[model samples]
Structure formats: C-alpha cells, structure tokens
Target: MDTSFLDSLSDSDFDLDLHLIMGKKSSQKKFATMLDSDDTDSMSSSTSSMRLDNMTENGLSEVQVGKDDLLDQCLDALYEKRGSTREKALASIIESFNSSLQNEFVETKFATLLQQCLNSIKKGSAKEVALASHAIGLLAVTVGPGEKAQEILEESLSPISDALRIRPETSKILSLLQCLAVITFVGGEDPEQTEKSMHIMWQVARPKLGANVAAFKPSPAVIAMMVSSWSFLLTTVNGWALNPKSWQESILYFSTLLDKDDRALRIAAGEALALIFEIGNLDKFCGENKDSSEPTIDEGKDSRKLMYLHGLRTKILGQVRGLSAEAGGKGSAKKDLNSQRNTFRDILDFLEDGYTPETSMKIGGDPLNTSSWTQLIQLNFLKHFLGGGFVKHMQENQFLHDVFGFTPKKKLLSGTEQRMSGSEKRMYKSPNSALSKARTQLLNKQRTLAQGRNAGHFAVDE
Candidate 1:
C-alpha cells in the first residue's frame, strides 16, 4: 500500500464520474484519493481544528524565514511549475500558520495567501487541486476563529461558490467539502464563527447534498461530509432551532442520512439529531427527560415547540414508514430499504420516551446508547494520543513508527446501501486507531516476554 498520500494524488488526476463512485464499491477507491490530509502538517497550531500538515520541513525552509519572508516563500512555492515543489511550499506555509497563528503579520499575509490558494484550486490538476484545497483549510484556521477570520473566509467563499454549486467530480468535491469542514471547526474554539460557517456551508452545500445531490445517487464523499458538517452545526449553534428554513432543510437532509444503509452516515445523522435534542434546548418546547442526558418536557411544555418537533418527527416517521413499504421481494434492495428500521425506530422511541414516563423506564432497560458519548471520549483520547507522550512513544517504537503515521478516520457512506442499520452499527472507529492499539498491545507483550527471559536467565545463573 502506497503510504505516500500526496504523491499518489499528485501522480494523476482521477476524473471519476458518479457512476464510477456510485456505491460502497468505488467509494473505498475514491476515498483512497481523499485520504492524504488527515492530521498531517509540517508544523503545528490548529491541530485542534484541521489536524493535518506535519510533513518533513527539510530544505522546505533551509534558514529561519521571517513572517513576511515565509508568506513570500509560500506564494513562490505554490506558483512553482513543479507539483512536488508547490505542494512542499503549501505545506510549509500551512505549518507556519498552525504554529504561529496569533502573529498578526502572519495572519494578515496568510489570509490573503489562503484566498489565492482557494482561487488556485480550479487551476491545478486533481492532486494540485486537492493540495490547494487543503491549504485553504489550513491557512483559514491560521487566521484564527475570530471575527476577522469570519469576514475573510466569507469573502473567499464567494469566489469558490460556482465550483461548489456546479458540482465537480469526486476528488475535487472531497477537497472542497473538507475545506468547508476544517475552516468551520477552526479547531472547535469559536462558536459564533462555527455557526456562521455552518450556515455558509449549508447555503453552498444544500442543493448538492442528500436527496438533492449530483444525480439520483449521492456521492459518498459528499454525503459523509454532510454528516460531519451537519453534526457540527447542531452541536455548536446557540439557537440551532431558530433558523426555520435551515432547520427544515436539515431534517430532510439528516433524515436522508438516517435512511442510509451505511453505518457511518446513519450514526452521523442520528447523533446530529440527538445533539439537537440534547442542546437545542428542546426542553423549552417538549419538556425534560429525567433519565437520559437529553432534556425532556416533564414540566409544562411549550405548545409551539411541541408542534414544531412533532412536525419534524412526523416527517421523519413518514420516511421510516415509506422505507418499511419495501420494494416487493426479498433481495439487496429490499433489505437495504428497511435496514435502518431499528435505528429510525429508536430515534422515534427516544423522542416519545423523552416525555412519556412509562416509556422512559422501558427505554432505560434497553442497551445504553453509547453513541452520544463517543465524540467526548474521542476528543479526550485525541488529546492524549496527540500529546507529547504519545508521539514520543511512537517515535521510540519501530513498528509503531509507520503505524502511527495515520489515524483512524470514519466517514458516512456514499452511493445508497443500508448495511450499517443500527445506531451502534452506524459509526465506526478509524482503522488507524485499531492499528495503534495493536502496536501498543504488541509492545506490552514484548515487555512481558523480555521480563520472563531475564528471570529464567537469573534462575539458571543461581
């Protein structure tokens, strides 16, 4: 397996049509191209946001370059005729931005530089475009999630709107979508900016997502991006329910995801919905839940909110029923149609049980939903995993070196198939995570073996 992610993307332009990327079949292949930008960067700053860039800095910046000189270097490298040189330059600037984000001069120069990168996205080959898209995300985070960055990002988005709206191929679309997600998150620090970015994303991304995508079949990469983007919106927005239009659209889109047979898409959609209930302050409308972490309508509920929730619930439930209709005989299609039967049922059950005392008891008896807790646990684990300690250990261990190179990153499925039907089944850990844990376990085994051998040697000497 070629671990040279950028080299692979740079090698050729993958002009993949929707048919080529229609289902899970081509999804893995297409995503292989999209795999280059995960927690990699030359330097560090916004790992809390974009979590990428960590490439070798050798010869990238031979001498210590000043902030202005660094920006000049980035632009110069980006404009280089050679793809490798250009990518190296872009990676350098991204690293600088990450480590010294608060520097005013760097922020100013980098902001302009980032816009250039966005504009350049349309100019390059598949690999070039992906790298350019990546630079926009990395540089945008460098601008920080302040009020200033928001305006700059908004300005940059307009220039790229047509590309997003017209709908490009899978590789290009993946890059653009990731750019949207990383910039919006800004390492999850600025709530206001995140909200605005979410709206901007919805505006640009809505028509191209879920029920209304490239064609009758949605792009897996695009769908997966929506799952993440939408979840962030619900989880972070202060008044998420205030935007009636977006709220309605989110429902249709999320319901569309919840209906997916792909485990990841379903979980992303489900968790987004769950977050809405938990933090959307739905209790103001529906009341409170005594048992679960989510709010309930145990007290006097607001009729308007209840009516609104009921409306959304009704729409979702209708979708589930339509799915239950099943297309005649038993086959893949039929199985896929009703695959999310239990998931949708649980969502509805959670909705009903939130307020119904008796249903609450029954729901409590059911297997605990560990889905909601995943993000928090993963966040802490990431902090620990990315900590100095973890990296040092990885550096010391030989097998761990290559193993820690990547991290497990799961996304929603593309092209419609409903295999991951349950909430528990819907989400998956990163394969990189499994590998990391395996290496650690192996290291422990080695330690035990060494200890035993030393004891035996000592016994023999005695």
Candidate 2:
C-alpha cells in the first residue's frame, strides 16, 4: 500500500460512497490520471516553499528544510507522477538530511518538527493524531543513533514532560514519548543513552507520582495513552533486564502507572510486572530473591521489603480479574475493544492460565458478560490463552455446561440430508435404516405415554 497517497487525502475524502458510484475500474483510472498530472508537482513545490518560509520566519535557521515539507513533496510526487519523479523526490528528501546536516540541525529543527508533530497529535482528531505519530516515528528512524541523537532525544523529552504538567491530558504526550522511547531503545545499546532516558522517566514520575499526590480523573484518551506508552516501555525493559541499573527507575515508573484507576492502565501494568518476573527482575521486586553473589539481607528486619512482591502480585491478579470482567461485560467501550481483549489474553498467557470452561462459566455469570464475552471471543488470545488441557478440564466440569448454556454443535455431514454418491448411499443404507426405525419407535412410545396420561386424567374427572 502506498501510504503517500493516503497522506494527501483526509479520511472523509477517501469516500467509499464515491468509489461505489464510480466502480472500481473507473475509480482506478481517475486516480491514475490525478497522479499523472503536473498539478501535483506545482502543489509540492508550493507547499515546500511555504513551509521553508515559515521555518525562517520562526527563527528556525538550523532546519533549512523540514521533514514535513519533504514528506509532503514525496507524497505529492508519489500521487502525481511515477518512476523517475517519485525516485527523485524521495532521493532529494533523503539527501537533504545527510550526516552533517543531520547532526547540525537534528537537535534544533528536527526536534522542533517532532515537537510540532506531537503538538498536532494532541490537537487533532484520532486519524490526524495517528498520522502525526507515524511522522514522529519516521523522524526518529531518519535521525538515527549516536551521542548527538541521544542528546537531542533527552532535550526533546523536556517539552513532553512540561506538556504533561501543563495539559494534564497526557494521551498525545504519552504517545510521542512511547515513540521516542522505542526509537532510543531499539536504535542502540549505549548505556549512557539508556541512563539518560531512564533519568528523564525518573524525573517525570518522582516528585508528582508519590502517595501524597491527589488523585485526578483522567480522560479515556489519557488512559489509552498511558496504557500504550507503558506497554512499549515494559517490552523494552524486559529486553534490558540483565542490566540491574536500568530496573530501578523503570520499575518505579510502571509501579506508578499500576496505581491508576483505569482498568487498561492496570492491565498494562500487570503484563509488564509479569514480564519483569519472567525476565529475572524478581530480585528487583523481592530483595530476598537476589543472587547468591549479592550480600545477604535479614529478611525479618524489613516489613516494607515484602510490599513490593505483594504489590506486584496483587496488581497482576487484579488486572487479570478486571480484564476478565471487562471482557465479560455488556457495555464495554467499543474503541480498541479487541486490542484490550488481546492485552488481557496476553496477560493470561504470561500467567500460563487458560480460558477454561470453568473460567468461561464465571465470566458468563457477570451481568456485562454478553458485551464483554462477544468482544473477547473475537481476540486470538481467547482461543489459546487457556491451553487445550485447561479447556478439557472445563469440559469435564459439570457446572461449566450450565454456565455457558450449551457447547457449540459441530456442522452436520452434508450427505446426511442430501442424496449421497452411490458408494456412500449403499455403505450407509443399513445403518441409516436402523436409525430411522429406532427414531420412529421412540416417537410412538412418547405419543402413547402422553395419550395414556391424558386418558387417566379425563377418566378421573368424569
């Protein structure tokens, strides 16, 4: 799929109604014609020139040309022309950000562009925000990895942190942060870079995330952002678990998100905690579980030490229960409902649990089960979260039958009701005849029983 074409059109402009009326072949012809025109070239040049002027006007001297402008040109070339024009446009954009230019302007204009994209994400609708998020990700990749890029990232985070403080609607800010974190973590294994990233996270959570901070109601958008960001962070942390120095700040960051009211937040936190345990962060949770090479501690002396393990397990289990309830509910949120269900299913798999018949029964009992279970069943996790063994165990549990109503019936053989092939018809004739005879006899017996009961009742009345 050419994403460049999509970059030019808003969601409404990609109208299915218009496509239906035009027919597929005609629509394709028109689309091709549009792309083949010189109009696209003029538009691209004009947009690029305007954006360059804007940068100069804003005192952004470092960024002679911005990624947005380049992307716009590429997209225009992609839509308007083919072959050489497209290649030339893409090459120009790529060549413009050479090593020297990248280093010189990355910290200033590049970072500023990303910040602007993030700001656009916060202000725009879902589709617009998603586009901005993608642009930010692309910028991260283009900027590449080094001490210079790392410093630029550290500098970039300051605005996001400030935005979080001022806006309080952290969904967009968190999305941008997730994009940044993923780039840094995946870009290289520089310990200094990792430390710098970790420090920024610590600073964000440290002063404001304590017990004394009063609870505030977060919008659904904010909650979604937190869940996405934390999920990405946890995945990275799991990969970095061998480095003990990285664990402290990350653990603290996740622990704070775990304390949020949103079920999605808790679910992400639980999955992260489960991952931490799997990746040998048990020592981080329980000092008692530390390696033998480490100094021994008096377990009895510290009551607070047990709090971490207790909190981790409690959080995980609570999230499991919450997700199970959500998936089992009648009026669950429709937005990303499948994503939420998958996340829950992942939690179940990480815990080595299955969606047993017994578990299904428990979920079925919930008032919200209709809405929740329907959504849950659509997720791939529902199929495998509980292994086959657990499923079998559920089948044997008698209450499970009553709870889920009935086991789904298998499809009948097509030949059972239709005319069969000669060989099949002959081979099954004797058995079919016997089954028919038995069914007839059973119906007769039932009729006789009913007649006798009616006669007895009438005779007594008479």
lDDT of 1 by residue, 1-462 (tens): 768875676423454544445543333322222223333333222222222222323222333445555556456556555554555455455545444432455445655676567656756555556667666765543344445445555655654555666556666666666676655544333455555556655654455456655543446556766556655444334443344333434554676675665654665565455445434334332322323334467654455545555666666656544543435353455454354454445445444333201111111122111223123222322233223333322222222222223221111131123354544343222224344355434533442333333222111111
Ten contiguous residues with the weakest lDDT in model 1: 355-364
Q: Candidate 1: where is the Cα deviation over 4 Å? A: 1-72, 81-84, 95-108, 185-200, 203-217, 281-462
By how many angstroms RMSD does model 1 differ from the true structure?
21.8
* Stretches of candidate 2 exceeding 4 Å from the true structure: 1-134, 146-151, 168-172, 186-192, 195-220, 237-263, 285-315, 318-322, 325-327, 334-342, 353-462
- Candidate 2 local lDDT, 244-268, one digit each (tens): 4334444445556655555566555
TM per candidate? 0.47, 0.41
CA-lDDT, candidates in order? 0.46, 0.41
Alpha carbon RMSD to native, model 2: 23.3
